[model samples]
Target: MEKLIDCHFHIWDLDANYYPWLTDNVSENVTKITGDYSSIRRNYLVEDFRKDIGDLNVVAAVHVQADADPKDSVKETQWLQSVADGSGNGMPQGIVARGALNADNAEEIIEAHCACPNMRGMRVEMHPGLNAPADYNPLKDEKWLRNFALLQKHDLVFEVRAASPEQTKDVIQLMRDHPETNFVFPHLALSIWRDEEAIAAWKRNIKIFGELPNAYIKLSGYGLFGLGWTTEMVRPYVMDVIDAMGPDQVVCGSNYPVDSMAAPYSRIWETHFQLLDDAGITGADRAKILHDNGKRVYKL
Candidate 1:
């Protein structure tokens, strides 16, 4: 079997700190959202992840931001870099740390994160519906354009995580505005609620994004879409994205821990395997989605 690179995995320890957003009202679809800190706080160290994959060659991994405190975001990257440096495991070769793109110190935050060896990019989470309060609208043009420019200045890949389809246009526009910046749309533009109209709108948006040479898409987080996501259930959506973006522009991501609520770690990988097999993607294409593309995107 070909080696894999899970480009969108996350690891968190609730005991270490707090994930304030983990509450009853977090998201109705996620069962683990209801669990207490202990239930959610299992040790998921780099070694644990390696053991979990067993024979599967996790040649490298890109650690996506896990919505912790902004300070903890930098700490998480440092911890992962230490692990990578000590053990020499190629997994976790890059980290996508968090920063308030709209914050006044955005450049400073990016510079601090980039100083770390494993820090490859930054994730500006745009979960407007879930995290945005009634008064807070992220669509304001000034902050949006300023944040996009910061990513370009630091030469960081921007990971856009919009919770709703309506926000896709804003993200795409940001990409268009900064033709030099590279952006990765995590979770297939994050339109996983199975809302037909929303999905359709996202498809149109993605088509436009696919034309942008600097854009990439991550095939991750199927579990977040709904409760039971078998390979067949998710295959059409995944294939449609692959068809739209082509294999070179897309990559696979495990979205682990968060995905553990819907299915165990093993099932998540198995589902990905089945989807790629059913799609008749060649081994080279599988390598690109699983490893090569991530290496290029994250510069791992």
Candidate 2:
């Protein structure tokens, strides 16, 4: 009996002419999205994802927003729904569609995504990178906050993606200001580092974000930023996150296709699971971190 609910992953078809982010020109322009994304630039439907999991016993999955063009965000939701419907067993029972928080028609885009039967919440990629807009100050902007209020009105979770340590600070403050909206922080609070000072700051900030009762952390998306695929490569960070966020607010995620850039599905999941075991996480508490917490957080 496989009993895991992967909280983050993606499925896209570049041939479908939908995802601008995966298009040739876009990939060329934003080369730093990862060290090398060429290996995953092809189509990856639900079946491919299922193949990757290979006996991991994934009962359900939650598809997080991929960086398709903003106009096609709702289309991505629709595509995932079709994939689930085709699968008959609901591979992605929940869909987190991308919505540009500062866009003029942000409400319309959110509504369009919410209209989909499987849509669960919205994600705005303010990861602060070369791909990120130079002028966008999501943490302090009026447009960003005003648009975020819409999530409160519609009862949607706001999935935050903080790519760097500086961005992590911004996400922490966002959660503090909007305690009403349930938040999902993916990528280990976006804290991947090598320097001692950086690790210390990230740990300190993790504690700050973890204390807030309004959010949950999805531990996924490793190896994408030059990190290796060994258990030792991730063990310290995994234990650190578990200690800070606690099992109740920490959920396991695969971050597939994107994480595929670093390692295969089995490798990442194995690494994550082993870390939990090494940290003495077992029984219902372990189940909560692996699957049960994802069900509760995403309302699966």
Candidate 3:
């Protein structure tokens, strides 16, 4: 069994914290990216994650915000830290809590989130929509930029979630603007794998981040390609990122429960391992993607 760090799994207690995505008119407000997400709308606790992971030696894990209501943002971090303390295994050693960068309380919210011992970073989704203009993102707003600078001050990582080409362009510029801040691009920058033109743009945009010393991308959420996706079907998109970013700049994550809508938790890892094997990513370089880079990037 290989030891790994799942840099992007999520755990949520629907009764304890209100996640709009899970509690709201779930069918009507379902994520368009994953289509119908009816399968994972239940409460997914740390124990559920342990059972799903089975025998895989997940040495440590990072819990990304589970789209909890912004009012409960800091509360979510505190809740996760409590989970870590009480779960016996300290499963989630790091957390990327939600921070609304453009809000009036942005700095205050970030400060509270950082106060949590498990907090390693914060995520403010920059991808407004697939067709939204690049400038439509918060990255264009001075207030958001000002709040984002706080990450550098506190030595916290910024998890970038831009999906569109327009959004990707804006994020690239944002990375250049904040050269001192560390940015982790999760979900392969939310690739649109079925589209060739999109892949081309993704390949081109990823190179810019790959060149920057402060940027890293997480190889998770292949389930975005749809539930029936095969290893070969997803190869070009995964390889394009690895090719541009290099294995050293890439990190692995399960993006679970959300991705469980597409495939089993164990199968997700198997697919990633196969992707790495077919790419001939072996030994130290392979370990960096599967384990080491996560430890360094998440500060675990």
Number of the top candidate by TM-score? 3
Q: Best lDDT goes to which candidate?
A: 3
Q: What's the true lDDT of residue 95 in model 2?
A: 91
- C-alpha lDDT score of every prediction, in listed order: 0.72, 0.78, 0.83
- Per-residue accuracy of model 2 over 1-300 as CA lDDT, tens digit each: 548899998888776537666765546534553666767778888888989989898888899877776657777787777778886368689898886888899899888888877788888767555356776667767887788999987778888765467767677777888898889888776544457888888789778867998878877877644646677766777888889888899988888887787787888778778888898988889899888998887788
* Model 2 misplaced stretches (Cα beyond 4 Å): 26-33, 128-130, 191-194, 225-227
Off by over 4 Å in 3: 27-29, 130-136, 191-194
Q: Model 1 over residues 121-221: C-alpha lDDT tens digits?
A: 88775655445555555656477566668777877888876546656667777777888778888776655456778777877777787788788988888
Model 3, residue pairs in steric clash? none
Which residue segments of model 1 deviate by more than 4 Å? Answer: 21-38, 87-90
Models 1 onward score TM values of: 0.87, 0.91, 0.93
Q: Name the better of 2 and 3 by lDDT.
A: 3
Report residue 216 deviation for candidate 2 (angstroms): 1.8
User: Candidate 3 lDDT, tens digit per residue, 99-155?
Assistant: 787788877888888887888998876665532344566867888888888888878
| Model 2, CA-based lDDT | 0.78
